[model samples]
Target chain A: MKLLEERIRQEGLILSAAVLKVDSFLNHQVDTQLALEIGREFGRLFADQRITKVLTIEASGIQFAMAAGIALNVPFVYAKKKKAVTLTEQVYSASVHSFTRQETYQVSISQQYLGPDDKVLIVDDFLATGAALIGLVDIVNESGAELAGVGCVIEKSFQEGRGLLEQKGVRVHSLARIASMSPGEIHFVDDPSPAYLVKEML
Target chain B: MKLLEERIRQEGLILSAAVLKVDSFLNHQVDTQLALEIGREFGRLFADQRITKVLTIEASGIQFAMAAGIALNVPFVYAKKKKAVTLTEQVYSASVHSFTRQETYQVSISQQYLGPDDKVLIVDDFLATGAALIGLVDIVNESGAELAGVGCVIEKSFQEGRGLLEQKGVRVHSLARIASMSPGEIHFVDDPSPAYLVKEML
Candidate 1:
């Protein structure tokens, strides 16, 4: 997580108080090694849960979900985003409003993938508005699948995403949880393990 | 590749002569171990190229690109699809017509990730019409990057995608090449690695 926070500090581009662009290494352009490490961290965090599958909403969340799936040795299901007004198939669906893109889309997964027999771990690249994550949680609940919780790569903690998920009793783990960020300076959550590790150094 | 071919033979749903859905394993729901094998296969095939990066279009291509990136130990970049008619900022853009979706969308990648110094291996889930892959190829060439080749998980060999890439002097390698398919039956190209492997087993 500290490594992720350092990468955010070094390479993350803060466009505004509410917008951050990690296109250089996280989303559009990806660092495979770093992604793998992030997966391992998620695996370590949720290793005890007996996760059966990893779930995510595409296109940004696919890589991290794939990574988490690899770490946990489980298959991953990426819910497809559709603009259609009607559900054509036997699928669990939820509507998500994107704060950045300024649009609401439907996210759905085939009924064949999840059921009462499955335990799911939801993963994503960012947790900002929490709209999309909440949508995924709703789908998971509707599918009769057990939710293992949510794992995020980077989180803008200032946003209400975490608070909303907590309200749903969703266990959340973000590798880099940003406490606050402005144009030039960014601060991570104070209790990050890196800070504790720093104090141990002689 | 043999493993992939067997998976397709067992699980692939053939909707019509022109459509085959492996969503249960390849795209929608991904088998992590199989995907890693695919990455390894791609890595082995293109290993001699000294690829500096792996490239693919977003959503479906992200997972394969991630896997290939892991196998090659290099970063990967996924182009974003946009509906905008005009270009904004500095980006390499290409217009692609999707036969299935019956719509044309623009695929764009930031100018920062690719350059003349980069050797790129274009990766994708399926090589059907080649519309999207060609768009990616044009983006890579436009950015002054070196094209190592194109790697596809499955190729409808009957389609013209392979021929078009060959005509453009782009090397192509698809793990599973289908010769033909219908509602009841499907057949792979004659020159598949799996058949050759099966000969060795006896």
Candidate 2:
């Protein structure tokens, strides 16, 4: 977690009062070695819980989820952003609005993958408004699977996503939680509490 | 490679004589254990090369690329299918057509990641049309980086992708090259060449 925090400070760029760009290391160009360390940290955090599978949404979340899965020795299942012709099976679907893209898209998981006995740990690169995480939780519920917890690489705690997930009784753990981001400056909260860890950043 | 071949024979499904579905283990639902093995295999295959970075496209390709990156102890970079707010820097862009999605999309890579001094290995889950691989290669060329080779989990030899790549003098290694496929049977090329030996079947 400290490694991730240090990396964010060193490479993360503040675009404005609201945006922090981690393209250098987290999202665009990945530090795979660092991701493995982050994954091991998450594995250590969730070692007590029985995590059957790690789930995440497509694109950015896939790499981090795969890292955690590898460290935990569990399978990782990613919800597709779009439905392709090959995806013919019935799916557990949810509509998610991307604040960045400024549009709504459907996120889905093949019904064949998630089962009633599975305990799902949702992972992602960042948690902004929590719209994506909410959608993932919806998909997990639709599959009749139990929600183990949520693991995130970086979380914007000032946002409302954490509150939304907490209201639904989901445990959230983030490696680095930003308390606030201003012009060229970023602050982090060291508390690991699920509630403040996700929603109190602003 | 043998594990991948066995997995395909046991869990892979052939659909309508056209589609090969390994959704249970490869793309949709990823088996981390299997991917760990794959990462080790790819690392071994490219051990002699000075691989500064592992390059791959987002979504499906991220998992295998991460696996190989971890195995090889290098950073991995994934190209975005679309531009997001998170991606604000100048990038090398290319047009790619998705065979399964039936649409053409632009793939972009941050210019910050690829450089003339970097030696990159392009990786993917499958090779059918080779359009994605070509686009990745184009980006690599645009950045003036040397491409060590292309690595694929599965390659459909019946398709023209491999030949096209080979014609361009890009060495391609596939874990499993399907010589041919039918409604009920999937045939793997029994003997792997020197180039194929580096490739494994997954």
Best by TM-score: 2
- Against the native complex, each candidate's DockQ, computed on alpha carbons, is 0.51, 0.76
TM-score between model 2 and native = 0.93
Which stretch of 10 consecutive residues in model 1 chain B shows the poorest summed lDDT?
B193-202
Task: Report the CA-based lDDT of candidate 2 relative to the real structure.
Answer: 0.85
- Worst 10-residue lDDT window, candidate 1 chain A: A193-202
> On a 0 to 100 scale, what is the lDDT of residue A52 in model 1?
99
Clashes of 1: 0
Sliding window of 10 residues with minimal summed lDDT for model 2 chain B: B193-202
**Per-model TM-score versus the true fold:** 0.92, 0.93
Model 2 CA deviation exceeding 4 Å by range: A191-202, B191-202
Residue A119 in candidate 2, Cα distance off native in Å: 1.0
Please provide, for model 2 over A96-156, each residue's C-alpha lDDT reduced to its tens digit, 9 standing for 90 to 100: 9988778999999899899899988899989889999999999999889999899999989
Who wins the lDDT comparison?
Answer: 1
